[model samples]
Target: MRIELQNTFVELRGEQNPVASAVLDALRSNGATVGAVAPVPDILIVSLPLLPVAGYDPATQLQSAMATGEAMFARGSGRVLFLVSAAAGMPMRRHAEFSVAMAGVLATVRTMAMQLGPKVLVNALGVGAIGEKVVAGDAAMLGHASVKRPGTVAEVADTALFFCDPLNSYTTGQMLSVDGGWSAGYGRNF
Candidate 1:
C-alpha cells in the first residue's frame, strides 16, 4: 500500500527517536508538511520507544499520547498513529514493565477509536527490535523474529504512512506489527 501525503500537515511526538526521524523523512519525501506541533494536525504520529531508561516513568508515554491526541481538532478528519512495542501483544517475559505499559497504549487506541469513531482514527504500530541492539535481553532480535532480522526504520515509516493516510479510514483502534512478524504468532510463543 502506497500513499501520497501531499499537502498533509503532520505532527510527531517523539522526534528524537530514530523511527520518528525515519517517519519524518518519509513524510517529507512524500510531500507531507511536517514540523513542530500544530494546534490541529491532519495526522499526529507518536513514537513510543521500548528502551528501558533509568528514572523513566511508565505513565509518561501513555499520558503524552492521550494529552496530545486530545488536542486534535477537525472532527471527521484526523489520524493518530502510535509507534509502540510489539511486546504489547506478545509479552516479553524479561521486560514485564514494558509489556504492561504498551498493553495500555493498545487498549487506549481501541478505546479512543471507539470514542472518536468515524471522526478521528486511532491506531498503533507494534515495533520490535528497531535498531535497539543495545537491549541485552533482545540481543538476538533477528533470531527471535520469524523473519530472522531486525525491522528497519524505513519499513516502519512505510507502515506509519499507511496508518496516517486518508485511505486508511476503515482501520482504526488497531495495532499493526512492524517487527518482522515477531508479534504475529511467530516469536516467543513456541
Candidate 2:
C-alpha cells in the first residue's frame, strides 16, 4: 500500500512550514511536480498550522481553505488534503480558538467532500503533538494517549502522500488521524 503520485502536479499552500517541505520532498520523490497554484492542480495541499500561531483566526483560515478548494475544483478532477491538528479534538480550556479551527477543518473536509464528490476527492490529516510540548493541550493530552510521545513531521507528510494517492479511490471526506492513538483514548486520564 505504498503511495504513488507519479506525474501528479501538487500545489502547496503553507508559509515556511517544515511539514509542507517534507510533503513536497516526498511528492517529488514519487514523481510529482511542486509548483505555483494553477487553475486546477492535480492535488491541492493546505498545510494548516499544527500549533496555534500568534494571529491565527479559525474562521478566516477555514474560509480561505474552502475558497482554495473551490477554486482548485474548477476543472472537476483533483484531490484536496488539509494538514490539520488532531489535538483540536482534545479541548483545553485555554485554547478555544485553536480547537475551533481544528474542528472547523474537520467539518469542512466532510462538507466539501459531499459537495464536490464523484470526481474531486477531499481529505485531511490530523496532526498531533509533533514535537516538544508547545501548548497546554499537548501536555495534557499526551498523558492520556497510549503513545506518550510526539509524532514526526515526516509522518504527517507520509499521510499526506496517502491521501493524495490516486489509487485511494473509495476514501473521501475523511480525516486519517496520525496522532499516535491519541484520539482512540485521548481524554482517558482527564
Candidate 3:
C-alpha cells in the first residue's frame, strides 16, 4: 500500500525528531511503501507544524490550515490522519492563540470527515507535551492527565497507525487524544 505523509517533520529533520523517527519506523514495520505516488494513496498523514500564529491575524491562521488541508485532500484518497498538538483543546496560557488556531484546524478535520465520508476516513491525533522525560514543569501543565507524564513519540506513532490502518474502517470524524487523558479531565493524583 502506498502512503504519503504530508507536512512531515521527516522532510525537515529527517528522523532527527523522535516523533518523525517513530512514524517512519512504524510505516516501514508494517511493510507499507512510504512516499510512493499512486492514483489514490492508501493513507495520507497530515502533520501540523507549530506555526507562529501568536499575535498574527486570525485570517492568516485560518488560511494556513485551510490551504494545507486542501492541498493534502487534493493529493490522495483513502484515509487521512491529521496530527496536531493537544494545545488545541487545552487552556494553555502561553499558547492561547496557537490553541485556538489548532482547534479551528480540528474543526476543519471534522468537516472534512463528514464531507469525505465512507470514501475518505479523516481523523486527528492530538499530541500532548512529549519529551524524553517528564520534567516537573511539564507535568505541572499536564497535571490533570491521568498518566501524569509527557507522552512519547512511540506512543503517538502507535495511535497514528491505528487510525491510518486500512483494515480499520468505520472510524472517522474523530479526534483521538494521545494525550494521556489530559483532555478528559483533571486526574491529579492527589
Candidate 4:
C-alpha cells in the first residue's frame, strides 16, 4: 500500500528527529509502500512539523492543508491520519499562526470524515513533543503536560500506524490527543 506523507522535511532533514525515524520504521514494519499523493490508492499521512519560528503565515498554510486534503480525498483511498501537535486546540505563545493553521487542518479532517464516511476514515493524532530536536525551532508546551517530558517517537508512530491500519473500519472525524495529558488540563503538583 502506498502512503503519502504531507510534511516530511523535518523528518528527512534532522538526524535527531526520532519521530520521523519511527514513522519510517513503522511503515517499513507494516510493509507499506510509501509515495506521493498521485491519482493512486494511497494511505494519506499528514504530519505537521513545528511551524517556522519566524514568518509564519496562517492563510498559506491553511490553503496548502486544504488543497492537500482535497487532493488526497479525490485521488487516494479514503484514509487520512493527521499526526500533528496539540497546538491545534491548545495555543502557545508566539504561535498564533501555527495554532490557526492546525485548527484548519483539524476542521478539514472533521468535514472530510463526515462527507466521506463509511468510505473514508479520517482521524487525527495530536502529539506534543517527540524530542528536543523535533521542537527545536518551535515553542514547545510539554512542560505543562502531566508527563512533563517529551513523548517517545514510537508512541506517536504506533498511533499513526493504528489509524492507518486497513482493518480500522469504524472510526472517522475524531481527534485523538496523544500529548501525555497535556490537553487534559493544567499539570500541577501540590
lDDT: which candidate is best? 2
Cα lDDT for residue 103, model 2? 81
1-190 per-residue lDDT for model 2 (tens digits): 2677776788887644666788788888888888974556788887777766545656665666677667756766888888877745554445667777678778888998998786788898877667564421265656655788877777777887788777778889988887777888733543
Per-candidate local distance difference test? 0.72, 0.73, 0.61, 0.61
* lDDT for each residue of candidate 3 in 1-190, tens digit (9 for 90 to 100): 3343342322111113455556668876666556644434456566664322365334454454444445556654466666766766654566667777778768877887887665667787777767756411134556777787777778888887787666678998888887787777763332
Clashes of each: 0, 0, 0, 0
Q: Residue 76 of candidate 4: its Cα lDDT?
A: 43
Identify the superior model by lDDT, candidate 1 or candidate 3: 1
Q: Over the full model, what C-alpha lDDT does candidate 2 score relative to the true structure?
A: 0.73
- The reply for model 2, stretches above 4 Å from the true place, is 132-139, 186-190
- Candidate 1 vs candidate 3, TM-score winner: 1
Q: Which candidate has the top score in TM-score?
A: 1
Q: Identify the superior model by TM-score, candidate 2 or candidate 3.
A: 2
- Candidate 1: residue pairs that collide: none
Alpha-carbon RMSD to native, per candidate: 2.9, 2.8, 5.7, 5.7
lDDT of 4 by residue, 90-124 (tens): 66556766777667768877987887656667788
Off by over 4 Å in 3: 1-17, 50-77, 133-140, 187-190
Comparing 1 and 4 on lDDT, the stronger one:
1
Error of 2 at 153 (Å): 1.6
Better of 1 and 2 by lDDT: 2
